[model samples]
Target chain A: MGKLKVLSVGALSTIQDEGRFGYRQFGIPQSGAMDISAMQNANHLVSNNPEWPVIETAIQGMKLEAIDETIISVTGAVVTLKINEHQVPMNASHQLQQGDILTISKPMGGVYFYLGIGGQLRANKDFGSYSTYIMAGFGGMEGRALKKGDILETQGGKPFKKHVIKQGTKPSMTETIRIMKGPEWKLLKDLPERTIFQVDPSSNRMGIRLIGDPLGIDGKEILSSAVIPGTIQLPPNGIPIVLMNDCQTTGGYPRIGKVVNEDMGRLSQLNPMHKLRLKIIPLEEALEKR
Target chain B: MNILKEKELPLLQFNKVSWDLFRLGEQSLLLQAPFDIPIEKIHDSAKLIKSVLGSLLTDIVPSYNSIALFHSFEESTIIEKLSTARGISQKKSTPIQKVEIPICYELGLDLEHVAEHSGISQDEVIDIHLNDTYRAILIGFTPGFIYMDGLDERLACPRKANPRKYLEFGSIGIGGEQTGIYSLASPGGWNIIGRTPLHLFDYKKQPPMSVEVGSEVSYVRITKQEFESWGS
Candidate 1:
């Protein structure tokens, strides 16, 4: 058994795995790590299963004190890591002794950082998942973000060989996101593929709201239909909102396109106000890319 | 002998009910039926797809005139399987399950607002709500939030200008032409009329929700005392 006491949580941090599945029919959002592959890679570095729950913290950073001997790995977002004031490289596994203190700095780029421990983190499971869905107040550390003085407990883990995922191999901040036409794509009057869109600061796990030149078409409300992560919804305001991991199961906005699944992890890492452009791809190319 | 056996079976109709299947990215498919089609038929098609796809599908969402199928399976495989399934007869005679929800009108946060909007007395509003039978059409927006149909045209009211940040579980509300109860405590924009004592959603239970699409719902008025003592 291992324990890590959170000294300070600088931003929104919660436990997340891949996500909760088979619950969208009930209108439950699939809340998970914003960058799924980064979370998986962090778990992989710690010798944990890719789907095991890990601590997902936003850009502001956090501090933790190891209460027991454990192995930990950090991934996602370009963040600075320090152990007892000594700088350490991220995307690498580090063995921590009892009472060791670890500090993670805010992302130099990107938005979320993941901390993976080499064991299962104890958390409440709702609808067969440990992922936190804050809107409904269920899952992970009593259904809320980690706070100061909170203790995270883990069970059954053995440190494997410490390794590092080479920089640039993993998902990084990207300004170009590939997309495919959605069900309501035909309703769009103009397709501004070359227009550079800026990520809105108000964006969160629920969605990445974008600000750019309006598509010059009124978004006619459609019958509330099925929506999934990566769906780009155009509301009456003409601005686009890219549905993220915590998006609702259904929406009434016109779905113009969906960010390709392959680019979702990279898209999640884009910092607020980061400029990006959408590239619409053919279905054949999308299927091939996947 | 095989030909004779094949001749004994009923001829399968081709394209009797068709939905336009479109791809939503690589992992999802959206099948949209015409809006003019009956919602029950859409529900039937959704059920048929679920029964056909079974474990291949990760999640299936049935909306007003569309069904979204989430899966990692090859899109062509799903489309082919659905095409074959559509030819099969899906007519079933299962009786509709009716749920009588006991509501306390005194708890209605916007009861007077709805009464003023409808130009009717509060008692008449309650009477109209209790007498009509509603059918759950689609469940979305929030977990276990069922959108029901069969609202009286007289009681139709636009959604509140500002949505409430929090609505208690089982709070019944009317929005535009739709009427339904908030199955879970959520932020909503509907004009609430009453509160039901029945728990519409319990996560610990096997199904979590007692009400589902196609279930019949009716309100039963109860006094404050009865509401307080419910399930005690």
Candidate 2:
């Protein structure tokens, strides 16, 4: 019954969980947390289940006033954390007394950050998930982004005292992400021997629009087919679009590459205008790394 | 085999990704399918390949014309299964169930617009629309929103220049040679001619989806009174 009421929702905030899976055949996009690893780490820090619901914020952080005493942790995008005006570490769990105000600022490095509570966040669930799907107008706080003065409830349970902080290596923000050739790769005539497309400003959860030389292609319309979260589709415009968690279940655009499952986390955290180099890797090598 | 030879079904080839498996992230693999074909045939092929791969492998997603196989195994057994499955000949098509949906032309908000644009009477528009059975070519754009083909060519109409702010759930609309029903309220450019009471998507249902790939859908025209009486 414990909860954390929102005093002021920061610049960008949304409720997210692991994701809703196995329903793509129905055309529902898998809307979930953008940074899967960060969400997991944040949950681990609070000893909550790895897939428990958490709040994801963009560059600017959120401010919350605790309704009840509880333990929480922040992870991803290196944001400055404070509890009642006292500075706190981003990756460690801390107890907040009721009425204590927590403020977080924009990230020093990354574009996204996560706040993990010890228990589940109170939000309406749709299709067995609490993640927001703004396009469908369902889930989360009225199926849209969190605004200021929104109250968030959580099932406050006893916090685990023994926090196992498994520090993992953070991916370099500047690293070029590799992608395997897409199904329609052969259709492209003048593809760079080494492909690296920069992310465009128009990118969001729906998909990442890339800025690159038009990939020359054999004239043909690819049949509409199933698209996964990491699919890289090339529309007739010739610019490749990398689909994300909120992407459609199927599409007709030509696919030139698919980001390996392991690299999607990295791509999810990429800011606008970030450059990503696409190196072709063997499926075996990619799987081995996983 | 004799039927295949007589039908002249094109032989589909399976080619493996020559370069490294493109990594989308830590948990997914994108297996490429050959491109270049009619949209319907590509969809058919993707559905066929999806069924084959779904039956042969575990924990893989067959996305639009591509297969995204997921695995937690350290040994890459999933890759082996995919490669082996890809090497085989095309599998037989599985039978898909047919769903009959009832639509009330009176409930269509843009029926007059459709009639006026096509230079036909409202009655003529309805007549042309109800004359043919539509096939579900694919399911996309939104959950349970089926992409149907086989609209009467005479009734073909382009999508609206500007998308409507909100299309009522169950609204049936035509865009070009395709006509589909909206499973949920969404912004759309399609010319909505009518609406149905049937629920195409329900979260509590066992399968969750009312229609599936390859399902044949036929529309039954009902009167506004009949729709209201049926509690549509």
Which candidate number maximizes lDDT?
A: 1
DockQ of each: 0.41, 0.32
Residue A5 displacement in candidate 2 (angstroms): 0.6
Say which docking band candidate 2 falls in.
Answer: acceptable
Per-model interface RMSD values are 8.9, 8.4
Worst 10 residues of 2 chain B by lDDT: B1-10
- Runs off by more than 4 Å, candidate 1: A169-174, A217-219, B1-15
Restricted to chain B, the TM-score per model reads 0.89, 0.74
Share of the reference A-B contacts seen in candidate 1: 0.75
Top-TM-score candidate index = 1
Model 1 per-residue lDDT tens digits across residues B41-139: 777776777777889988889899888988868877877777777556446635777988899999999999999999999999999988899999898
TM-score of 1: 0.93
Write model 2 residue lDDT over B167-220, tens digit each, in one string. Answer: 888999998878887888888889999998877787779677687655788889
